[model samples]
Target: MKKMILSALMLAGLVSCQQDFNPGTNGSSLTVRSGTSFGMCVGYCRQEVVIDNKNTVFTKTSREADKNPPVTCEKQTDSGTWNEIATKVNFDAFQKIPETLGCPDCADGGAEYVEIQLNDSRHRVTFEYNKTIPGFEDLVTAVRQQRNAFADCK
Candidate 1:
């Protein structure tokens, strides 16, 4: 009876540890992506940035591919920046936020989106461009800053 109780306690401990684990904290399986798009626009109508444990990639697409084509840039991600953004990630809170907030890109006002993937789970939120997300302000800001850093990619 004592042996069985000990085994049950050990199993409970293991389950609790798994419940508290957050992959974003270590960035081992964390990926963050953000982008902006314009429905009625010239030049590059869409811009995106993806950051993961290994690197950061920036891409821009033009509505008229023949006129401007597309641009892509990549570089190693800075550990400090990655940690700063990773620490701000609260997947539980993020999942509570609606996938689409307000009217995105209505009347060509533009739209922005942020997406996070950890292990096998992923979440994405889209809103009006330049609008703030209630619980994800800091993460969004960090992602936008990272995206802006590649403005000269083209």
Candidate 2:
């Protein structure tokens, strides 16, 4: 029964398209791949690509926002600069996106952060810094918010 349920979930994940996931944190370690591409956004249309432990998404705002926002950005900081991707979008294949974060015209530079989260909070977030990102922190917070949510993961 457990195997059957897991298979169904995998199929659903593939077909779902949203990539926004509500995965129970049960893996030995959560692997996060943060890669920025030039051509196109994978799975979903986003400027930056963030794949979470559950294959969830860390989506960005429109390319315009990255470019010239109605407001203004002086430097590449959290304020005017595009520091973090918005974490609200959920996985839905059918949902239509009016605009998307387009690819960079001339790919300048970006950073990829691969973080592994141990089930134990005591352990450093990753082997290196053991520090966590805002997105990962949101997941941990969500897990804790739910009553006995991580009971299964433990």
Best by TM-score: 1
Which digits, one per residue and each the tens of the lDDT, describe model 2 over residues 1-154?
9999999999998876433423332332333323233333332222222233333333333345545332211111132111122232222311222222232223523222333232332111211111223435553333222212212221
Pick the lDDT winner: 1
What C-alpha lDDT does candidate 2 achieve relative to the native structure?
Answer: 0.31
lDDT of 1 by residue, 26-88 (tens): 667888999999999999999999998779999999989999989999999998888888887
Give per-model TM-scores: 0.85, 0.22
Model 1, residue 111: displacement in angstroms? 0.2
**Superposed Cα deviation of residue 102, candidate 1 (Å):** 1.2
Measured on C-alpha atoms, candidate 1 has an lDDT of: 0.88
lDDT of each: 0.88, 0.31
